[model samples]
Target chain A: MVKSRRTKAGDIGIAAICLLLMIICLLPMLNVLARSLSSSQAIIRNEVLLWPKGWNLEAYKFVLTDSKYTWSLAWTAILTVICTFVSMVMTTLCAYPLIYRDLKGRRLFNTLILFTMYFNAGTIPHYLLYKDLGLLNHPLVLIIPNSLSVFYMIIMRTFFYSIPDSLRESAEIDGAGPIRILFSIYLPLSKPVLATLSLFYAVGRWNGFSDALMYMNNRTYHPIQLLLYNILNAITSIEIQTQEGFASAPGLSDTIQAATVMFATVPILLVYPWLQKYFISGATLGALKD
Target chain B: MKRSSAINRKRIANYLRKYWTLYLMLSIPLAYFVVFRYIPMTYVQIAFKKYSIVKSPWEMPWADNNGFEYFIKAFRNLDFLYALRNTLLLNFLDLVLGFPAPIILALLLNELPFPRFKRLTQSVAYLPHFLSWIIIAGLAKQLFAPTNGMINIALNRLGFESVPFLNDPVHWVFTYVFLGIWRNVGWNTIIYLAALTNINPELYEASAIDGANRWQNIRYITLPGLRPTIITLLILALGQILSSEFDRPFALTNPLVNSVSQVISIFVYRYGIRGLQFSLTTAVGLFQSLICVIFLMAANALAKRFGERGIW
Candidate 1:
């Protein structure tokens, strides 16, 4: 009887913490949304918090109308699609063949592939190689170099390994070749894992900034994240200029920064429901670390 | 013997012919790994050679001081030292503050009775993890900006001083760590939560029968079940002690916070890529990588000595 009452107290305490976490997670983003919608007068006067004050859509209008911003958005969307398709094909190819237990040089291939996951040659050599390959300032630098993720490939290979051997054996007994077996049996059955990995690949490509930061000098080819990074860096310099009092860039307003963040963030945020649904299994699979 | 050799040849031929397509399929990814990944490893010797436009780094003579010039330079350079100090300091703080946040959250979450609220809390928390650091930086500027910043403004209205969250170096480090925790804590709980489900309900029932309180149940059953997962993750995380994701420091840092924010990756970007100081930067990179591997091995060995399953 005493224990039950104690348990109820514990439960309430836990619920309160969860509620606090939800608010912590929710409030700042709502603040960004509020700042983005509020008038510059109210924003400067420090009126906005969780809700808008003197609300307007001028920042969104400015961002949507700007060619540089809109072009990168569209360009990144296209890049995401291309990267996802190419990466899926590349990853599937890398993973499917390795599941053959009796394949020649399997151990060697596995060792070689897995080594890349742990030890990258670090950034200098990677950059130098990209420079030598004539990919510097080229957009293919992003797509080609990061084409195969050994981690994701391992996830796929493990998934492939889990499909029963008897399934493959029956396909082989029917005189289906390895390719036929992979397509008709393995590929068809592996849609959920494939979709999950594809979503990850797409989202990763969409958010990627570092490669472009390092490998390219071309501003026009910058993706949305890179664009935002440049904008953020530019604003820091402005903040230094105005640090004594207030930051007031001519075109880059507080509302505009908030709106830009929303634009960059919303696509991935829109994918959250699907990510919430898919990621638990994906997380568990990746967590296996096999 | 000749007839047996002929039969073996036929068997080899059949094996090769049957699985030829698989090998063909493997070649593309293998080629990518070779060209993009492995070949660069050999070029790490550039750290030892002199930079030249007319000759490759390999063709250039060994650098000053018998090939230890750049390593010494990196250690001695004030900016590099600052970066090293900041990297270790920031990551250590993250290790202290950021590491256990998820485990604690997961434990608290396990005690929560409402399934719907638990799911909603998790979904909301995980949302921030998916957003890019650039987006997070924007959010930070919005809330933490002085004077007009929402949080600072709120504080002022409440008769408190504005916090220099982004402007000051010491506060910057803590803010950076907090942002990191905010981004990762919820998402990280997924691993611990998954581990929690693997613990047997029978243990909980037995503990309850023995009159073990909730704290005691967790102390005995849940934590013990999570030990291997925790240790494995810790060992893996140690490998990344020197090499963090280049994105966060690169994105979240500003000129004011540069002293604290200039990590090794930023060092490499500034000197190697931008300054074209290939020898010095590659030495730093190699040194960073070597230390990372050492930390990883040392951590794994330590874990094994204590009879835990390390990541290996």
Candidate 2:
């Protein structure tokens, strides 16, 4: 009875600690949400705390109705989908040929790929190359240049190496080609890895702003993150110039920024829970071998 | 003999034919690397000449080789050095403070008994990792505002003087480091937690049976278990010492705090993009990459000597 009581007490203590930690992690985001929804007067009064003083959705309405935001969202979505597909295909195909243990010069190919992680042609030369190739302002510029990530390729190759040799041997005996075996046998077993890597590539493409800033001279081609960045910069400059304080337009102050952040964050956050299980597994599978 | 040689040739051809589709699939990626990665490497020579967009890189308009002209110029520029110093100093602070927070958090999380709550806390902690630097920085500015900011209001409520958080140069590094920890600590903790999961449970059971306390168990067992991961990640971070630009400082920088904010990448951007000194920009970039490569190699060698599995 005493031991049971002790265990119960321990459980309660752990539960309390966990709850506190979760709040700490989540408070900033919740604060942002609260500020976004509060009335301008309430924001000025600084009365808004855990909940908005007087709720309003004007910020959301403004951000959503804005053509820049909408166009950038469309741009981000297209880029994410196309980049994810290309990255996955490149990784899988490059990994497949290198996975064959008996392949001559496999070590050389592996080393060459790994070398890219440590050294690169630097940024300007890359820009010049894109300029020379007439890839500047082309949407494919974003997709093609960064299509093959050596880290992802290495992970895929490691996964392919783990597949039992007998599966390939049996398939070969049945007159199956390498491509057929890859499609029929290897790919099905690689679902977890595929999902994890796809999420990685998608998130990267969605969040990518530097490429848009550098390559895309036109404002229309900017991704959603870039748009948000510009808005944030504008807000900062406004605050710097006025010194009038956030209370002047309290309704617009907290909530709009918060809403914009949430809008940028929500899509990736929504996908994470669905792919959470695979993320850890994929990370382990990739890291454990080497 | 001729027949045997022909058969040998036929076998080689058959092998090539069998794997042709696989090679075909790999062609696009190979071409991408050649055109985007390898070919651009040739343009690094433009750093030695006065390069113009009108004339190709091979056509040098200037007679001077300019052996170290750009490097000397970049070194002499006080703004460049100030930026370099600020970058190194901030990175050092991040290494000192930011590196350990995740390990400690992971350790604390590991000790907690409730699984559901633990998982929930972890998810919440990692949410900020997905936020773009712009959003995070904006949030920071709002939260740390001198008058209307939540932090200052709380401090005033507690009867303390409100601090100038963002504008003050003295406070800039602190804000940068604090935000860095807030944004990245959870994501990094996840890696450590993953490492912890791989540790055998029996070792903990054995330590418990020996009457070891929780702290001792962590010090003796958990810390040792995390050594390889810590080392590997440290080496990776060291390799990125010259490359951490565009995210934290970029978002935090303003004219007020520009002294402490400009990093090597920002420097490159200023010279390359805004100034349009393409050759000088490329030279600076090449110098940064070379430094990173040397650091990575040295770290890898050190890891090998210490008997840890290095990136190599």
- Candidate 1 Cα errors over 4 Å, as ranges: A1-3, A236-252
Count backbone clashes in candidate 2: 3
- Model 2 chain A: which ten-residue window has the lowest total lDDT? A240-249
TM-score of chain A of each: 0.92, 0.88
Candidate with maximal lDDT:
1
Query: For residue B310, what is the lDDT in candidate 2?
Result: 93
Please name the candidate that would achieve the greatest TM-score relative to the true structure: 1
- The Cα RMSD across the true interface for model 1 is 1.2
Q: Summarize candidate 2's per-residue lDDT along A146-228 as a digit string, tens digits.
A: 88888878777788888898999999899999889999999999888998889778878887788878877777777887777
Give a tens-digit lDDT track for model 2, residues B1-312: 999999999987887777777677667666767777778888887777788779888886652544567777778888778867887888888888888888888887887777877888787777777777877777776677677777787888899999988888879889889888888887788678878988999998897777776668889999999999899989988877766577667778877888788888788777787688887788788888898899888889999998989986
lDDT tens digits by residue: candidate 1, B40-122: 99889988888676776568888889888888888889999998988898888888898889999989888887999888888
Candidate 1 at B24: error in angstroms?
0.8
True contacts kept of each: 0.81, 0.49
